[model samples]
Target: MSSDLPALILGVLCGTGGTIGYVKTGSVPSLVAGLGVGALYTYSSQRIRNNLPYGIELALLASTVLAGSSVPRAIKTGKPLPQVLSVLAASGLIYYGVKFMQRE
Candidate 1:
């Protein structure tokens, strides 16, 4: 599976969010999840050379979790942007992940 630009960007977004969460909450779990999840999504690209096994699928799972989590907040806040972007990213990731699995 070729790691593409979109996934990388999403990973950065996740990592940045995690960093921010860490700064705000001072929680070890938040720190780990953010960086871990970010790397799972972002570092699977060309730079990693021998990327993590099942990286795309793992990234897809992460994006799905993001989408699932954002939906409730969007609904409660009546803000559609977060939900829309998360859903779109998850859908795209799912598509690529499926294609990668099929190719394998």
Candidate 2:
């Protein structure tokens, strides 16, 4: 789990950029970036389903990425919803991810 942290962060970055890009301009590249991360994450989580990979984690990850990606757009558009959501999702993911890492 620890070893995957970097990949998770990378996914977060790509997802964030893609989400915001798509939202701001409806660009295909951004949409692709966001969906690509989502697909990869889903595949990985499913592969490890024997460990009880609930859907919540995947949702949190996706939403968090969406929220994070929404930041730049929010800044330009002066919207606060995405940032607020990102904060909430960030808190939840931190707690959840920590608990998950501790599992035997």
Candidate 3:
């Protein structure tokens, strides 16, 4: 678990980067954020030797949604639709993903 800290930090950094990218480009930062979170989660899960019933892809999607929404908020865009939708979608994905994992 100790060794996974670097990966976790990397994930957070990537997540932040994605948020920045989205703020600047108004494009979805899904890929970047997903990569970061997936790497960290994978590394941590592996270090702990857990089954990690929730797959990396699902985790990445959830992370992307979680981190992606911050872009609009940070930019102070008055239009709340994109930000709200992104957050809701991300949250839903995560919620369902967790439920799926628990069932496994």
Q: How well does each candidate superpose onto the true structure, as a TM-score?
A: 0.58, 0.41, 0.34
lDDT of 2 at 69: 65
Quickly count the clashes in candidate 2: 0
The alpha-carbon root-mean-square deviation between model 2 and the true structure, to one decimal in Å, is: 8.1
- Candidate 2, residues 7-93: lDDT per residue as tens digits? 355456556766887999989976795667656555444534445455345644654665566656666777675465456446546
lDDT of 1 by residue, 1-104 (tens): 54566667777877787787789988776567667767766765433336546656656766766666666767788776556646755665676677577858
Q: Can you rank all candidates by TM-score, best first?
A: 1, 2, 3
TM-score of 1: 0.58
Number of the predicted model whose lDDT against the real structure is largest: 1
Clashing residue pairs found in predicted model 2: none
lDDT of 3: 0.51
Model 2: lDDT equals 0.57
Candidate 1: what lDDT?
0.66
What ranges in model 1 sit over 4 Å off?
20-36, 46-52, 84-88, 91-95, 101-104
**All models: lDDT?**
0.66, 0.57, 0.51
